[model samples]
Target: MEVKKVDFRNKIRHQRIMKNTSAEFTYSFPVIRGIQAGREYYTTMCPLKLVPRLFKFVEDDLPPDLRAQRTLNKQRIPALARYIIDNKESYAFSSLTVSIDGEVHFEPTDSDPIKSKLGVLSIPMESRFLINDGQHRRAAIEEALQECPELADETISVVFFVDAGLNRSQQMFADLNRYAVRTTRSLGILYDHRDPLAQLARTLADTVPVFAGMTEKEKTTISNRSRKLFTLSSIYQATKQLLRKGKNDKISNQEKKLAFEFWKEISNNIPDWNLCKQKKVAAYELRSDYVHAHGIALSALAIAGSALIATYPASWKKNLKAIKALDWSRHNKTIWEGRALIAGRLSKAKTNVTLTSNLLKQTLSIPLDPSEEEIEMHYAAGKK
Candidate 1:
């Protein structure tokens, strides 16, 4: 039961689509047809310039319950557009998944029976093409063209599914996203070649004496049974906080040197960290027993480091040495119960970081800024 193969002229183009919406007129494309799960689908390459004009975003006016696709998040468009614009020579985007609600035709190239699946796809000009996925890419391409009109000719892969109603389209959207999972933060940092802080974190994880052998490179959280002592993301975050850098800020050589030296100094001063490095004690023992062995300790120390450098530019390293004698036991309820732990479990909440850093600042004899004092006052008020 072979379906008929229709031959369409290669010259047939979108100009004809605009000329008429008659039943005979269709938007033609070179596509390869395939079947999956007993349903017909097509894959084609489309010019970026045609994306905005060809596939319309689901109107936000429709309530989410009634819509087939998620509403476009306009806030995300600018940054995405910038990725394309900035990395015009090397940017990569995945295929856009689309659904069509009208009639279509396929013209298989008749050169060989073995290549029958290779063909041309044509849809009626009046048909509606709604993006099921990659709506952000579609929107971003439209935006990128505004600034780099030359990119209009560049092509993006598109996946097309034929359907007649919203119910099927909605199911498509749900089914597509059901298994989608964001990569773990540490893994993202590991693979990231762009962010300067992420690059610095990678360097720290590899070369720093304390982090080299024990840093967990892929997972954000370390299990109690695991041998690793620090997470790559924690190193990334702590360095970011220590430098007071913005998300996409560039790191100078001087800043990188400062981060390396500060973490090295911290490693030298922590008794448990030194013991673990010397193999005198197990890493998990410190992690389980001391508040300072967890990621929040690094975050709190980084925050304090930033302030110490700011307030005591001449002797920040000397001030940083005071942590060697501090009691960092998890059971130190009087010192760390509210600041770094809640119910004896380490917490990384915003207030917890602030409170923990405030304690570190006080220990180093550094003065607190007004906002820190305000938050301290609020925490005290809540306690009573």
Candidate 2:
């Protein structure tokens, strides 16, 4: 049954709703009627309404006329389509940047689990393309947006800073990231250096491109390692902590400078650093020695050797030549170009002990005979 037109201006003589809440009713009114000529009143035609009970059967309740059905169908489709179309823009913009609110909007893709979430909180507040964080997230967002324009409206949340600040960058990064179940490149950008722990990381990053050039993916790799704290971060922290603990000890300025210089000399001389340069030792072996021998022992050895070389260049000339040759093997244009394909694996695994030590021993091994007692003493004294 069609809904008959109702006149808005009709005045009812009386109106009342049923006292029982369960009772439903519709009001009836008169349709407009013609007026009579020569002062005569006219009565309106009867109007009728169907109560709720009349809507029980579908076929009977609906209008019998096909024209009415067609009009309703036309109106419904366009309304539904418009709602869907308008949402497309908002979803598309989510790809633009990680926003300040820490809510990330990621584009939907087949590979991602349906509930994957993105964004960072308490991160730096910069709007620039991330130099150090969220590589995979960025890549996924960029790729998705490129493929689906509708997803460009998505946004990612992040805290960002332009430069490393007051040595707090790395620590701050760690603090914000300690609970992050998933790792991202943004962690690399947060390396700050105030505390001794962070200072070591800063120093290492300064010395090595692997740390400095770290993408978001590398941060994940670094985080999973047990030796992470003992690395650059550990060394720097230990030095800082020792200094702070001794602040009242009336240490001389010259002594302090020499102490730090000594510390750096030891850090740079670690077997792993040598591995990065593809020296006589391999990375893993160096790591093993570092673990077993203690940092202080190796540090003292490095300091002693460096001091000896500085004072008696003639005596250490062969050692200097060996150092130069190793450095040359690492970056020499002629050697790199000629052997890149053959040595690419070795070069990338620059710190691999088995690979690097074997290569070095085969190529340029030198013999050194230190007494076992001296080695033992160094080991005993060097536990840091």
Candidate 3:
């Protein structure tokens, strides 16, 4: 055994053995030991800088059957990296789980019951580490470090488990992901404070008289019998289009005020929406008959509303009032068949959104741009 002082710069991952022995040398971590299904496991904090040096990505080029983790989606790395870089102060990361295949040593601090649970874990340099989960996060961290090297000192928690062979590692990967459930988009909008559009949507749902108590805050889609009429994600997308903003564009105070005033005007003009808000009509009745109750129509209306503001900034509201004259019933399939409905089902496909927006723009007396005109030409040709 080699004798060396504890170093924080070692490029090593960890594992543990249950032998009653002392750790004399090699990569070490002050860890808390725990048990799972009658087996030993250790948890430790790892510095951001050493993370890239150790825990090398299991090459995706390796066959799926031979590897313990999925191939990393390289496209996702940029967005995740941007999230970390943009929200350095408030970002939260969960612990990473890894399996180690080598002998390890554990040294308890002292004799007390609580101290017995705490110890330093040591593993050799020749050991291999396999990620059971969080490969995306690891890749994101490496990418973030390239732009902001000062984050090297920050630490992330990692959970280490011991098992031999690729078979055990593969099983660990499967078990970690077996029960995971993704968060709903509406819930994401509800809890997200980092997204300006999400904040705008949540505030509209809470403060807008017509929307309060009439919006679904948990699910992206509203059920047939649900008392709610609109969804939070729909509000986010509609408001985004209403302001003519891209997915990640920054919004100013002026733009936010415009969004608020526009929605308020829309609320005052739509009798069907207001009727549902007042409980004068069942949600199902309005939803079944109206185009305005669905995301497709809301997005399309916002798209046209954007053009209306640009075309006649002084008279957009007067032009918007013309929507009350235009038929909004699902039964008006003659006009909406190819635009909003495909085979009697509402469709939110890209072409459908543009087509529906074209009709609304014409109703508002706003001219379509060149691209929209091209789409209109294509749709008109398909009619024959």
Instruction: Assess candidate 3 and give its TM-score to the true structure.
Output: 0.92
**Collision count for each candidate, in order:** 0, 45, 0
TM-score of each: 0.93, 0.23, 0.92
Off by over 4 Å in 2: 1-190, 193-201, 204-230, 245-260, 267-276, 289-384
Model 1 over residues 1-384: C-alpha lDDT tens digits?
Answer: 222233323422652432244324567788888998898899988888888988888579998888988888999999999999989999999999999989888889876865888887878878889889999999899999999999977889999999859899999999999999999999999998989899999999888898988899999988977778899999999999999997779999999999999999999898678778778888889998998888889999999999899988889898889987889988878888877888888899988999999999989998888999999998788667
For model 2, residues 26-98, the per-residue Cα lDDT tens digits are: 3332222222233211122211121111111122244534111111233344433343344444322111111
Question: lDDT by residue for model 3 over 1-384, one digit each (tens)?
Answer: 334464455433344323356553357788899989888999998988877877778668899989888999999999989988988987778988988888977889988989988988877777788788888999899999999998898888999998668888888888989998888889998998877788888988888788899999999888889989999989889988899776667889888877877887888778888989888998889888888889998899899999888888888888789888888888998888888998778899999999999999988888899999999998889788
The better candidate by lDDT, 2 or 3, is: 3
Angstrom error of the Cα, residue 121, model 3: value is 1.1
- Once fitted onto the true fold, the runs of candidate 1 whose alpha carbons sit more than 4 angstroms away are 1-12, 15-23
lDDT of each: 0.87, 0.32, 0.85
In angstroms, how far off is 33's CA in candidate 2?
52
